[model samples]
Target: MDTVRETTSAIKLLEQENIPYTLHSYPTENGPVAAVDVAAYFGYAPERLFKTLVTSDHKGGYYVFCLPAEKRMDLKKAASVVGVKNLQMLKPEIFEELTGYTHGGCSPFGLRTKLPIYVDHSANNWDAIYVSGGKVGYLVEVQPKVLENLVDAQYAEFTK
Candidate 1:
């Protein structure tokens, strides 16, 4: 397959590792689309899509969470899992500053820094998951284990 820079760093890494993947992009309207929308348009199950969320511990430490699209992350539980006393989401500008990606384009694949990555245990239940390709209207489908392995993420109870 032809490699493209539109993908996240993680996707690039997958390419470098010779992992097979397929990239998908669609019409975007500059807003968060329901996971069901992606599934409906892409012809995949909603359960097979993950969303990348950028959050922080009150101490100014930012981290990323890759969770199933159907579930929401429990901030309290995430803070406890990461051993942080307080957890909150960073401001939109802060996220752009830290991750070098816009709100809708954030992908856990490659970031400006190696932020702690937490993948919900539910992700392991799926063989392939579709994640953002560092831009709105773009996504990449890859093996779930490959994503976790590339990011060196910890498996945790990240969803509500």
Candidate 2:
């Protein structure tokens, strides 16, 4: 483990709010990193690691969902929950502009856009889940409740 700590919007928020968390780090990679790979790097079960996904209605509306790394999103059903006919994964080209974080580094806490956040119900199955630390190669181990409260998020059965 590295003794040096890196700062990111998510980490800042955790510090400011006095939330308890364990920060984990890995070698920085040049391209997009997959959620499952991250979990493997930390030796955590895939179910206890989450990936933050941003979707758009192809209009101006956008939404966020956090789900287990090993699961797949049920796009059609997720759209139905938000009353949107459909939802498309957000483009990597503008991920940073929209969320203030890179593709694999998006954390629900520090998104630039004020979008609705939905956490998969499965997250409650773990005492703590690992999510991006607002940067690639970094992750934060935190209680699921901290995430919901931080983002005013809801729980949904949106994964298959």
Number of the top candidate by TM-score? 2
| Number of clashing pairs per prediction, in order | 2, 0
Cα RMSD to native, each candidate?
A: 2.4, 1.7
User: What is the model-wide C-alpha lDDT for candidate 2?
Assistant: 0.87
TM-scores, all models, native as reference: 0.88, 0.93
- Per residue, candidate 2 scores C-alpha lDDT tens digits across 1-160 of 4589779998898988999998888887553378887777778899999899999896668899999999999999899988899999988887899899988789988778788999999889989998889998888999999978888989998898
Local lDDT at 1 for model 1: 28
Weakest 10 consecutive residues of candidate 2 by summed lDDT? 29-38
Strongest candidate by lDDT: 2
List clashing residue pairs in candidate 2.
Answer: none
